[model samples]
Target: MRDMTGLEWFKSSYSGNDGPECVEVALTAEHIHIRDSKTADGDRLTVSADTWTSFLSHAVPRV
Candidate 1:
């Protein structure tokens, strides 16, 4: 992972504080960045805005 200089990162409130399954997301106009909370600076995954929205829609399921 690079410096990530000015990326804005946020965590999901639904994810508990003491879970290894937690992840953090960073947003930019061009791409969305995702990384494991436990290994944030190790490896991060990047995706487009459209793909990110699609992922969230599927990952969260419908209410």
Candidate 2:
């Protein structure tokens, strides 16, 4: 995983404003960084853009 310093992170729109289960994401040119919103300093999961898109395709149901 690359250094996440200076990266701008955002929470999922489905996340509740005061929920502890919020997930945060940071995007870079080469990878997507995911981490728990409540633990900014904790370990994060990083994946390529293509991998992220593929996961979303299966994880999110078709409308």
Candidate 3:
């Protein structure tokens, strides 16, 4: 795993203030860190930058 000490995590802007299902994402040099905002101490999901870009591209299609 890569060091994420300096990674800046941001919650999805679309997420509501009291949203139950919220995710936090941090970009690192090697991979993107994804974790549940509700369970920050829980395990995280890491994905390569390229894969993350592709995933987002499909997850949120351009209208």
29-59: candidate 2 lDDT, tens digit per residue: 9999999878889999999999999999999
The CA lDDT at 56 in model 3 is 92
Per-prediction backbone clash count: 0, 0, 0
User: Arrange candidates by TM-score, highest first: which order?
Assistant: 2, 3, 1
Q: For each candidate, give its TM-score against the true structure.
A: 0.77, 0.87, 0.79
lDDT of 3 by residue, 1-63 (tens): 223466677887788988879888988787989988888778889999999999999999699
lDDT accuracy of residue 4 in candidate 3: 40
**lDDT for predicted candidate 1 compared with the true structure:** 0.83
- Residue-wise lDDT of candidate 1 within 1-63, one digit each (tens)? 244477777788898878888888888888998888888778889999999999889898688
Window of ten residues with lowest summed lDDT in model 1: 1-10
**Which one wins by TM-score: 1 or 2?**
2
The residue ranges of model 2 lying beyond 4 angstroms of the native Cα positions read 1-4
Model 2's TM-score against the true structure: 0.87
RMSD of 2: 3.4
RMSD to native for every prediction? 2.9, 3.4, 3.8
RMSD of 1: 2.9
